[model samples]
Target: MGDDGPAARPNILVIMFDQLTPGALGCYGNRVTHAPTIDRLAREGVVFDAAYSNSPLCTPARYCMMTGRLPSATRGYDNAAYLPSTIPTMAHYARAGGYRTVLDGKMHFVGPDQLHGFEERRTTDIYPADFGWTPDWLRPDERIDWWFHNMDSVTRAGVAEVTNQLLFDDEVGHQGVRALHDLARDDDPRPWLLVVSFTHPHDPYVTRGRYWDLYEGADIPLPEISAADVPLDPHTARLRRVSAMDEVRINPDDVRNARRAYYGNISYLDEWTARLTATLGALGVADDTVVMLLADHGDMLGERGLWYKMNFFEGSARVPLIVHAPKRFSPKRVAAPVSLVDVLPTVTDLVGAAAPAPVDPLAGRSLIDLCAGDPTVEREVVGEYMGEGAIAPIVMIRRGDLKYVHSPVDPDQLYDLAVDPHERVNLAADSAWSAQVKAFREQVDRDWDMDALHTDVLADQARRRLVDSALRTGRVTPWEYTPPADGSGQYMRNHLDLNEVERTARFPR
Candidate 1:
């Protein structure tokens, strides 16, 4: 063993994919996916089998992962909210510890000073200031006015129909690869922490011709959807309405087509990840790098009549997490349930960095010991989804073999995950599984109280707008709050006053 602990202090390369589920990868044994690179990573690294997102939505999940705090702790439990500046983020800690931190691709940051703790942001985001939907919050020149203005033209004329020509393509994988190549050439004396955030496998599911053809003729499975599958709880019923999969009531063929397209996107991301890894190797940094692969959250391709995310279902909450530590940690599968919040502490622990003073209690535990192959240790992962509009709140707890989901609007849901991995049967109302359901529900309630997950001014506003938009327009629009141009800092000072007006007028608090 080396006394210097060379393995303990390796360069960190964190690669995150947007909205990718473990089930969509070949390493997870998905028959339809052609994700060879990700599969190779799994073979070389420690693959986490039951890793989950603290929250199913994007911003909240990313906030939890970056801060080592629960989404509720940051009060950024929705996509529209901005990450608070005060949180002790992973990048900040790494930079403070003398690591050169670089961020490329999407961070989904909403306000000025979007760089957060990263030393540099290499690429401009493809998403508009208002999360790619509206131009109201963007600068006059920076707004995506063309997308909206030419929407009719594109729809009518099929203009720009070439494969992989979309904005996300330019910003995510390719930009991330370029950033890696650039970072490799940097002569900075300090070790580096590089974040390559890819926007792939997200919506508008477009990929290059090579990736698209990789999954040709692959049979994709459709989710189980039946009227009898309805939960006895009304809260779950409300959640089902907000779940995008509800709109996909088409035939089996259409479902398969959609699944194939989603797999194509995943494969596209895999190719880019392979390229990034190759770049690292070419720079002679592969052996000294600790590469961590994870998704901010998972997506429900069509599981149980759920599409997209923002639910407590397994397909939505469970994500793939793989950590390839430099030689010190042996490759092994971690079956224990883990959350994205664990990411911050794990990275901090690995890099020998100090966390911020007055750091809030972390909801996640470091996986270092677990990665060392410690047995007899287990963890229960919890997830929550506060319905945007009229949708009821959904809470889930997964301990081991059983998973319980509580809904305020619909019937409570219980599944014997060990027996029915597909989650085809609900045992909540079954008297035989009453004890299991009760125990899981109690565990969930205790966890919620422990984490202080509760409704607040911001959460309330989020819920109202989310529900209103879902009910009225059938989609959630990005938040459009703009700061003043004069840089007077008055907007930040008077945020409460502005938010009051916004809550009351814009979202009808």
Candidate 2:
């Protein structure tokens, strides 16, 4: 940690969207997506060409990004896995360093510990807050179609005036803008850290009528790996079962409509990001704010015949990361590989705050130099998947132009991304690449004890299921996280609500 001065520290705003793959953006070389706002930010900011989520699922990925620790070490094995409240997150460190930290949207916390260290959390989570989503390793082939992912989201995708995800995101945006207004007006001297997370572009592959019309009759991008050419890897075949892909028959029309709606949803998210950034300018704090944007994980978007995130394919793991702080860092593209786990350290670096003293030491470093267009040497991006689609601990290592995926039960995969960008060829078992595969396997063994970790994960799942069953005796099933005094404490931004603000402020007079 380095301290410049109290006043020198800038306010940090993190805009995180769900399931956004970087390649789909206009700045990332896609010519069809209508996301001009994000493209503008990429032009003005430091764009990481190879940024990934260390954990390629929703809950585990957020936990890893929050704590700068690996999923296994944090006990964040699955979506329903509870992150112990004692784990000191970045918000806690920021607060200790004299920053007002706030969260305004989804984090997908499964247990009762909602606010890890945020001073304020607005807009309760769109997903559940209990162990209802916990997966059982004993039943590997059983498809939990009731809640687990399915093709229905893709098969029945289209336009709508409003949706479950749209309303939640609208509220998230409303509260986020209001929170910014309040922070601007408040007399607090500390710097601020506001994370505005959104749940859009995630599911049901739908958007509003306005955004849906943006891509009317547009030629949607189909799967890169065609149906006939899709080589079935072991892990991918498992995902097919977990997602129930075989249960439904999806035609080319379904693919076109789903891709159209997904692209439309990205445009809507771009509009949301624009609104937040425009508000920063409107409040006259644009110059003193440092804005960063990334996603927890990425959507396959029908790439390689995959829909959503589960494996460590570039489509599912790689995400967009852009950091814009014109006063502190230069604007350029960094081609080195980075991870979401670096965010905590990056924020601490930007604000001159010391890293949090955690139960386990951090494995991430700050991206300050990378933002200055200087990248580290020998950058290797590492990620793990203990969520769904696997019974064993799945690990992946990406260094240079090569990506290595390893698991005990599945066949090892090695791909030279520079030569074969689509990962169509696996050089794992080839004798010519035996040295690379051997080195990567040795690293995996040193990094994790797969057999012990597997048993521990099973035990942890059993304990959680027992607790869930006992709690369901008299308590509500599928507990939702609704914060106290929801929406009643929001600040007034419009003239229609001015009297309400005044009335609430002048109470007991």
Candidate 3:
């Protein structure tokens, strides 16, 4: 904001979406769906080909990006998991380095401390910030119908001009546009970091008629792999029971409608992308802004007969990561594997900010080198899931061309992406790749104590359940954020000079 010329610290804009997979975008090789704005960013930016959500669930994956730590380290194992106030986030780091940090939409933060270091949170979160959604590992067979996702999102998918998600995202976009205008007018000397996160194309697949008609009569592709095509592993079988997929009779139409609605929402988000970036250009700050786009996690969208996220499958785990800063770096595609945890370090590196050494050491390495076209950067990504549909902790390590999934209760799964991209065959049991699988097994053993992690998750779940039950018995005080109103000082208030206010508010004056 100051007159530091080319040496001025760049403003950072992070645009994030929920339950969006790389396969849904045109730049990621989806020919059916239309997302021209995002495609333009990818065409003129650094695109990471194999970026994944460290944890496939919403809250855990978000926490991983916010703290640069894993669920095991942060104890943020589920949707209701709490992130302690002590953990320093990218917001805290940016604010410390003389930046105004603001959050416009959903971060899925749980517990009493909602704004974990954000200077200004523009909107209240869409999801509950309490422990009501905690998963009960003690009763693994019991399903909480109120909170658990079911086939209703698929079977009842269609055109809707209004939905709870649509309403929330609309406000998020409006607030983002207003925030940019306010930032342009503010007298604060510090550069700003704005996070405009949208919860879209996530679930309850529905969209407006205009977006829905974009794919009308267009042949939509079905899932390449079906549940019947391969034998179900223990985890996949558990997921089926958890989502109540076995109860519903899904026909071809149900899958088609759901995919259509999901694609429509993708276009909706693309529109917002165009709006926000265009606002930056109108404010004459586009050249000094670093725009990065990513997602909390990916949706299965009925891929492999799975919907929503909570697994290590490519559809659920892989996310779109693109950094559009032609002024800072060249446009190129990096094939190296990365994950959500790397976001914190990468952002800090980009803005020349500092994230103090965390209590639990950060599990991510900075991707700035990879964005700069360094071929020797690490290509490893680690993932963990200890949330619902699991009786034990499951972990995944993707390195080079192979992905290894391990859980104490289920059989190991090994897939070589170089050969079998769809993961149809499980090479874990094959004697030919025994040595590589053995190496992966040993690495898992050294990296994690699965038994201990399982016990810890169970114990935390019990504590949260007990606390939630006790709190619901009396007058409940909700933890949801409520933004403050500043009506007295806004617009043409008599407290300030009216002419000065008008002069500052008018852009391009």
Candidate 4:
């Protein structure tokens, strides 16, 4: 550990993945995937077994985590939802607390203000920053084929040495390594926070031959509950059409191949995780840094006829959370449910940083106490989805062993995870659980005005659509981020003294 004084703040490295589910990780009990680095981290860190994404979509989930608020509070309704520049993020708080904040990869920021609060952003986002992906609840049945997920990702899954996603993640990994080396050499006095996020194991499920060959003879199991096994719910039925599942015919071979590729990509990310952690160790910052691993949300991966995330099913919403700070926290597994919204506050607490008084009440409390095994902390997780899969707001509350999902249009669902871990039975309809159902419904009524939220979502969608149309009409300036580079600052520059330049460039000074 560093000095106990207030001036000695530890660096924080947050390694995040896209659409990574706990079910696929070996630490979380999947025997097939090869993630030794992650497994080792699990052994040394505090693991939250029931961690979930507050929102299942990309933009809203990232926004909620960054702001320590829920989707509705930020008005981050969907993929194209705009986050106003005025909102304070985790980076803002870290910077305010005298830490150097940096982001090395994808954050899915969906507006012109790309650098939310980071002092430096090392890579451009993988997804677009425009409002072109805004969902219209008015036309709930239509699928935006151009951008919406489809069966093609599964039907065409295979091994590839280089893919768009792979290339992006390669750069993400390289930049993160380079940033750590640079930070080690720099004379900056402040502790640093670097978010090394990757866009992989997400979809189109392709991986390098090296990674794919790792699972050559391994047994890849199919989904426990297949589409043919159970009837689809209303939201999943809508997701099926949204993702164009009905238009394509997927055989068992396609499913197996896709699963194999997904597992391989996970191995590929494991390799990156090794690289980042190794760099931290080589830089001699391993002990003085706190490492966190999590994901924005989980991929359904052909669970119950679903592929991508949209609903609050355990497969889609459950994320893997590991906080590795052995010197500061003892290793333990926390079965209590936690959510992505808790990230900002937790990071603040981990670094001993003081966040500015929040503009609004934070939806999350610090998990540091819980990481240290404090039992008095509440064990509840709240989630809301105003994304493409539904016409109305869907809210979820996970308390103790029960998970209750509610929406105005569809029938409510209640699952007792203690006894029925697979969520096979819906206790909401059982006469014996009527009181429990009513309590959840009343809690929903007390917390969310579903009707008002629906109206607000529709209005926001209309406004964004109008703005998108106007922007596309003429000489369009894209909101897509392009990283800046200064050519004159390259090696052996004409303006610098040769000896000093070489001395400064070399490490181990």
Task: Assess every candidate by TM-score.
Answer: 0.79, 0.93, 0.98, 0.97
lDDT per residue (tens digit) for residues 1-509 in model 4? 44662224689999999999899999999999999999999999999999999999989999989999998999998999999999899999889877899999999998899998999999999999999999999999888889988898999989888899999999999999999987877778788999999998899888899988999989988888888776567988899988999898887788888999999999989999999999888877888888999999999888787797988989999999999988778899998899998999987786573656566789988889989999777778999999997999999999999999999999999999999877778899999999999999999999988999989999999999999999999899998788889989867888988998777676666
Who wins the lDDT comparison? 3
**lDDT value for candidate 2?**
0.86
What does the lDDT read for residue 184 in candidate 1?
Answer: 59
Ranking by TM-score: 3, 4, 2, 1
Model 2 clash pairs are none
Off by over 4 Å in 4: 1-8
| Candidate 4: residue 228 Cα off by (Å) | 3.2
Scored against the true structure, residue 382 in model 1 reaches a CA lDDT of 69
Candidate lDDT (C-alpha), each:
0.67, 0.86, 0.91, 0.90
Model 4 scores a TM of 0.97
In each prediction, how many residue pairs overlap at the backbone (N, C-alpha, C within less than 3 A)? 14, 0, 0, 0
How many steric clashes does model 4 contain? 0
Candidate 1: TM-score?
0.79
Tens-digit lDDT string for candidate 1 (131-169): 222112112223233442211211122113344425655
In model 2, which range of ten residues has the least summed lDDT?
1-10
The sequence of per-residue lDDT tens digits that candidate 3 reaches over residues 1-509 is 33544335788999999999999999999998989999999999999999999999999999999999999999999999999999999898888877899999999999999899899999999999999999988788888899998999999999988999999999999999999999988878678899999999899899999999999887898999998887799998889999999898988899999999999999999999999999999999887888999999998887788889899999999999999988778999999999999988877776583534445678898888988888877678999998999889999999998999999999999999989888899999999999999999999999999989999999999999999999899899999999888899888887899899888898864
